[model samples]
Target: MRDIIEPEFEIDEKGRVLCKTHSNFEFFSQPKVNRYQQRELEKQLTCETCSHFFNDDCFFPRSEVNMIEYDRKKRNAFKCKLCGNKIDRMLTVMHKLYYKEKYNIELPLICCTCYETLKDGKFIESSKWRSNMFLYNALYAIYSLISVLFFILVYQVRIYYLLVFLLPIIYLFYQNMKKRKEIKEGMRYYQKYFIDSNNNNIR
Candidate 1:
């Protein structure tokens, strides 16, 4: 069983919950998307994922916690990069640091499953991938639809004339398929990896 510490937040002077432990509270980590759409301003700022409420070092009442990520995290709308599942857009301080240290890339706002998958060493070179596979999926669907159209046109007397139009469509699909393969290949892992819990700073 994972030992997730209870959320350690404190009431501010105004009696509002707050956590001032992040490396930079004013960091430009929030995406250009609708960051404030859902009402979790307090949670986002406090960052329950951190072990420190404000960098409590030794000798003092220090902050400490184990590593725990989430899916169905908040009632916000953000999509996962791998499975294309809906997720909240809570880019905690840990995620930002992890991305920079591990992948040397920007932290992607992913669902819990994808985050777990990444920690388990099934994903790498994530920067080459996309946040959504919608365009790739649309390409595949269009190719299938065009194939059905080709079948219907094959029986027509103007089949030769229709071939010219279908040829261009087929080329486009081929290019998109090649790009899709590249995206999937980037997610392949060279070896299994695991993130050990800090118990103090956490993964």
Candidate 2:
């Protein structure tokens, strides 16, 4: 239920949920942190998967979050300093901000994949990310197949009202297309900043 959101038939459905850490704390006040009180005093944490964290509500980098890809050529378009792989923009920034705030150390670009590495200094991206992604895709494929079969059956029967089954499929497709556009443009925008910053750093 919390993993995905289904938008209305006629409306744009973008899933927005706070990561566990920030879910406790909203805009106005700090969420209750019993053992984390000391850490809370130092700096407010940001959710790496949220676009709003970057002050951009126009785009949700779902691709960056889901990162569903196997092509090595497309790995980490913005190479992470740690793994030299495509990295999540928000995760990198979140790591930077957290380190700067907590340890007073500035970190270079790091990916969510490198989290365990950073934690244990092992430099190995956990396989769970890929495994979880595979699971999601497998489930998605099942959904798509069912949708196609349902659509075909309903169409062949020429049932008028039963076409409602297709509505969810159609709605999701449109929403997917809409988010794909946003992700495409969002990557470009992030790429521009990456280039500029890289150039500046090199200078």
Candidate 3:
């Protein structure tokens, strides 16, 4: 008799994965792409929602697409230009070492696996960069949530004097949420584009 694999509980025991749909719960629950990728992708590709080939005035502004195509002429299929993994997303990277200086060498399409692994830590950022990022995510993301609760408490207390104190925190929270929305939009844009492309291919 074959053994059954039971559903696994979430780390905090808040939920359980019961099927294929639930396998990537966290990844699905939230946006996939980050802010940096969104800004970069927008700068390179056409309309994020457009089904047409991503060749727009914005695409490869720093370099010629024909030259990039020539570079990959030997390759028969799309793959990560950096690690040779299957293409998941396009990344327009500035290559200082590859050319005279200040050149956009757009060939590498990053796979999702690599994106997840390289998005964090010293792998992609310097120590100072990581430290600033930590401060932002920790200070703003966490403190903003805390401020919401504090706002309610202050309001119930009818403490008008504390309004001055709470307003700044509220403003910061709003800014953070705005940034979060942009990042989420970016993720949704790319995920939908790729998924739709795959579906069309299958059809």
Write the number of the candidate with greater lDDT, choosing between 1 and 3: 1
lDDT of 3 by residue, 13-77 (tens): 11211122223334323432687754543343311222122333332322443444444444524
TM-score of each: 0.28, 0.29, 0.27
After superposition on all C-alphas, the RMSD of every candidate to the true structure, in Å, is 14.7, 16.8, 21.5
Clashing pairs in 1: none
**Candidate 1 TM-score, C-alpha based:** 0.28
| Comparing 2 and 3 on lDDT, the stronger one | 2
> What does candidate 2's lDDT look like per residue over 158-194, in tens digits?
5654456567655655555443443344344434554
Better of 1 and 3 by TM-score: 1
What's the lDDT for all of these models? 0.44, 0.42, 0.39
Q: Which scores higher on lDDT, 1 or 2?
A: 1
Which predicted model would earn the best lDDT?
1
RMSD score of candidate 2 (Å): 16.8
TM-score, model 2 to reference? 0.29
Instruction: Please give the clash total of every predicted structure, in order.
Output: 0, 1, 0
